[model samples]
Target: MLRIHFSSGDLARTRIAEEPDPLWETVLSLQQLREKSREPVLDGWRRRRCARGGRALRTLSPLMPSRGYFPDFLTPAEGSGGLESGIDAVLSTPRRQLCGELELLADHNPLPSEVRRLAEGETGALRRLGRALRDYHASVLEPGWRDIASRIEGDRRHRTETQCRLGTEEMLRSFAPLMGWQSPVLCADYPVERDVHLQGRGLLLVPSYFCRRTPVALLDETLWPVLVYPARPLCSDTPAAPSARLAPLLGHTRAAVLQALQTPRTTSELARCTGVSVSSASEHATVLRRAGLVASTRQRHHVRHTLTQLGDHLLTGVQLGRIPPPSASRHHGRA
Candidate 1:
């Protein structure tokens, strides 16, 4: 069970208590904000942009919150009008938690490569935004899970197709003017290319609504909850999230092998620490490399093995015990 409270302003003083069953407070506190816009002129431009491509307004959709939670577009206040009155509720909550939940719920999501295209060289922005949404879910949402169940009943729940698209279009339109003026000089020639990347990447454009500075939110939309990050922030830099995926190996043997490999190592050294035969050690390395967990680089006559991102994740998981051991899963098999 988790508990959370929200307020219109002064978050710390708002009595917005949030608690998750496992106490994922660290994951829930980072917070996410977005660029809000109020320019109808920009909206008209975005409509033209949408028309240029076969992509309709229907293509721009909002990422919904998890199924069990209340639809963000709805409010606790009974008889509130649709959307307009519920705007704050729809936008509230940290962005990181939303992104994480969406990833957990959906089958496919954007990775670094997709993100780079959307960000236009703003990797740091994407990361911070993703993390912020995840944190919001963990910290601000209500504890009673069932409270949201009835509201989300079956097909017509939470985010309707139209509502979702409208929200997304509104955000994109807000950025149109800026995209025309502030974007790279070459961007004008390649408008469609830029548009595809930005919209595909979940970039939000807000007018001068939040501030006079440039406004946008690079968000993670795949996550069910949807994560967001502010475009032009007041802070020097936003907080970062701990890696979501873990390293691929576990146990003392794997740890020892990794530590010894400041430079890549031979199977013999791996076997010595692992207390296995050279043949057995070589087999383990082979499996790791095949899984993209380790890399092999040639050094003289010997082929040395070094851990890759997945391999490092295995090691981290072993240390943290947050993820299950590699051996426990059939995918890893016996090595």
Candidate 2:
């Protein structure tokens, strides 16, 4: 069990990551590739076939074993910036920290030849690690980035909705079955028994697409507190065509607009995704908002739209053939 103790100050500072961190996704996805979890959502990504002959798979395999501690430097906080920036941070790890983390990894598991150079802090070893990370992301992650991004965005949207509707603590508690929130401590299922006292640094909850079953944390508690938890499956980037009832009832373009909103998008962005003009997108959004199917928030000139709880349930139910036509008691309309 992993218990994360939070103080009042810590609670005030705690916040969810705005988007997926590329390095975290890369490292966790590599681990997922090594393991045989065979989750359906990952099956599409897995089919890409990470060939062992590939420099990325061979070089990175040793570090990301099926279990146990992986080096923390591999996923630096700079990852919040983007991929290249994150890789730069990984490559620029000070020798002292590099050696210490590698030593810790070695203590738990046998260090392979590829990683031994890193353990010894040999020249250019970090550069090689950087290349392997970039190569794997290009080969595996970049290809399906849209799908990955949308899925993570969907999870973030759900979290935001939860936080807005019910207080922050309620949002934390909503992670039940996966995690339990008992006031000061948030409990999670983990391979080891550990306690993380947030003190006052706060915790950054990073949602990941590939961190299946268990949440991951940095072995070194001194660094910023970060928890990478599995993101909830929302929808495929290119969702299946709207259900027969959905398309006919909402009309095709509006239905397409609704599907495009699985992840929040601005008016122009929505127009591009739904293949409609900007005005059309705006019109569709206004109607959906009136029906309580979508909630729109304006940020200067552009307005971002996301599915409301009613919209989410309606779309999900109709797609699954579980929802019937709405009655006057329940507010909503066609598209």
On lDDT, the leading prediction is 2
The regions of model 1 sitting more than 4 angstroms off are: 1-263, 317-335
Candidate 2 clashing pairs?
none
- Candidate 2 global CA lDDT score: 0.79
Of candidate 2, the 10-residue stretch with the lowest lDDT total is 236-245
TM-score of 2: 0.67
Question: Each candidate: what lDDT?
Answer: 0.32, 0.79
Which tens-of-lDDT digit does each residue in 1-335 have in candidate 1? 01111122212121101111111111111111212233332333334443322221111112322112212212112112322223333234345543444444344433344333322424454444344333333223223223222222211221234235554222222222122121111011211222222222222111111123222122232322121112222122322111211223244334444543433567654554334456866876776677777898777876778877666665454452344456644676324
RMSD of 1: 22.4
- Model 1 — TM-score against the truth? 0.20
